[model samples]
Target: MKHIFIVSLALLSLCAVAQQKPNNEVSLDALTTETQFSSDSPDLVEFIWWIPNEFWEASFSQDPSISASEAQEIVSLVEDYTIVIALKGKIGVFGGINYEDVDHIQKEFTVTYNGTDLRLIGEKELNADTRNFISMMKPMISNMLGPMGENMNFFIYDNKKSPINVFEEGYIQFTLGDYETGTELPLGSLLQEKQCSVTKKLHNGKWSYCPYHGVPLTNK
Candidate 1:
C-alpha cells in the first residue's frame, strides 16, 4: 500500500513539474496592440518585440525572468507599427519615453526579422543625453534597415525625414526583412563607412555586431 502511495506521489510531482514549465510560444499580433498608455511619459513601458527562437532560448537561459508574454506583447506592438514593403519584409518604428533628467537619458529600441521565428535584427540604446548618442543611433537605424532593403528589394523609410526630439528622453525604430539563404546579409552585417560594421557574431555564438563596424561586438 505504501509503495502504491509513493508511486502516485511521484507521478503527481512529475505532472506538476511539467505544468510549471514555461511555454515559450508567442504570437506577433498580440504584441502590437495599442496599450492604454502614451509615449509621452517616462515610464518603463514593456516593448515585446519579435526575436528568433535560438536567440530567445539563449536569452531565456541566461535570464529566466524574462516572461514569454512580454516577448509576445513587444512583437505585436512592433508589427502594428511596421510598414510592409514586400511579401516577406516590413519595417516598424516606434518610440516612447524612458527616463529624462537634466543631463541624462535612457531609451530602448528593437528591430525584428520575421523570416525565422521572430529574429531580432536590431536593437539600440540612447544614453547620456549627448548629441553623439543621437547621431550614433541614426546610422545604427540606417544600418539595420539597409541590409533588409537590399536583400529583400525594398527601401526603408528614412528617419531623418521625420525627426524626433525627446527633450531628455530617446526614441526607437524597428525594421524587418525577408529570409534570404546563403551569404546575402543585412546592413548590420556589412560596412557602412570607413571600416565601420554594424553586426558581428560573438564568441558565444551570438550575433551582437558593432553598430558602426560590421564586426563582433562587445559591451564597452
Candidate 2:
C-alpha cells in the first residue's frame, strides 16, 4: 500500500509539471486587438509588437535604466508586435500579427515627441514617388500639431481620404512640430495621451524618417 501511494504521488507531480506553461514565449494571436476611441473620425486599427526591454536595449545598443534579466522576464508577459489602424466614426482597431509576416511589409514611419517637439519620420518604397504626397501632407501635419503648449494632441487622418502607397524603394520624412527649447522635458519622454504617428516597412528592413527639421532625411 505504501509503495502504491508513493507511485501515485510521483505521477501527480509529474502531471502538474507537464501542465505548467513557460513564461517568456508569446503567441502572435494573443497580441492583436481592435480598439474604439471617441472621436469624429473613423475607427482606427492598431497592431502591437512587444519586445523585451533587454532585447530592445540590445538591438538598439542603448542601455536603459532596467536590468536585462528583468526586461526579458517582463517582455514574456506582453506580445512582441503592435499594429493599429483607424476605422469609421472615431473608432479604431488594433492587434498583433505574425512576427514573420509583420517584419516583411515594406513601409515605415517614425514619430518622436519630446514634450515640446514632435517629429514625424516616414519611409516608403523607392518605386513610388512620394514627393507630391509629402508636399500635400505638410498642411495636414501642421494641423495635427494644433497649438503646442503643456499637453499636445496627435491625430491620424482618414486613410481612405488620403491613401498612402508603398513602393519598391522607400523614402523617409521626419517632421518636428512646434517645440520650446529651454523646457524641462527630456528626450524620449512618453506622452500621457494617445499620441498620433504613422509607420510602415517591408520585410525586416529599416524604416526611414525625416530629421527634426521636417525635411526628409534621405535628402540630407
Candidate 3:
C-alpha cells in the first residue's frame, strides 16, 4: 500500500509541474492587438512590442532577472525601426505611408491580407495609395503568417500591434527590369537620407550600424 501511495504522489507532482509551465503557444493576435496609438500623444506612432527570451539572453543586456527561457512582455524601446523590413524583400517601396503626416508615419508596419482597420490606431480613414499597397502585400504577408519561426522576426505597430517579419533570403532572385530607371523608390530614398530607421542585414549575418547614431541598425 505504501508503494502504491508513493507512485500516486509522484504522478500528482508531475501533473502539477506540467500544469504550471507557461504555454509556449502564445496568441499572435492578442499580443499584437495590445499596441495602441492616441491623438493626444506627442507622437503618432507608439513603440511597443513583445520580446522573446532569446533576445534578452543573446545580449544579456538586461538584468539577471530576464532569462533566456522566459519571454518579456510590453517592450516599447525601439531604434532605427521601420515597416520596410516586413516586406520580405518582395518590393522596394513605401507607397501607403506619408512621412510628413505623423499619422502615416509607419512604426514597424507589416503587410497583411486582413482588411485595413485604421480604427485600431485612432484613424478614421486610410490613404487610397496606402490601401492599394497593403493589398499588394497581402499574398507576400500570407506566405509567412503563423507562429514565430526560425527565420521570422517581430515588429511592433505604432505601439498598438505586433506583426511577424519573415526573412526569406533571395525570395525574389531578380526583377525583369526597372519600371522607372531614374526615379528612385520614395521609401528607399528616404531610408538613404537617414529619415527612417530600418535596419539592413550585412553579408556577415549581422545587422548594419548607424554611423551618425553610433548604434546597431536594428529594432529593439
Cα RMSD, model 3: 20.8
Model 3 off-target regions past 4 Å? 1-62, 72-101, 106-220
The reply for model 2, stretches above 4 Å from the true place, is: 1-63, 80-220
lDDT of 3 by residue, 1-220 (tens): 9999999777644322211112232233332332211122232212223232222223232446655444222112221112222211121254232222222324323323122221122222434443454345445544544321212223322423532221211111111111101111111111111211434432111123455554434322
lDDT of each: 0.28, 0.26, 0.28
Candidate 1's displacement at residue 37, Å, is 11
| Stronger candidate by TM-score (1 vs 2) | 1
Model 2 poorest 10 in a row by lDDT: 186-195
Candidate 1, residues 86-171: lDDT per residue as tens digits?
Answer: 21312234542232221221112223232222221222321233224233334543464454323222112222323222111222
For all predictions, the C-alpha RMSD in Å is: 21.3, 23.7, 20.8
Residue-wise C-alpha lDDT for candidate 2, range 169-211, written one tens digit per residue: 2221222112111211111111111111222111111112222
Full ranking by TM-score: 1, 3, 2
- Which pairs of residues have clashing backbones in candidate 3? 32-162, 35-159, 35-160, 36-159, 36-160, 46-158, 46-159, 80-197, 96-130
Q: Could you give me the TM-score of model 2 versus the true structure? A: 0.17
Error (Å) of candidate 2 at residue 45 is 11
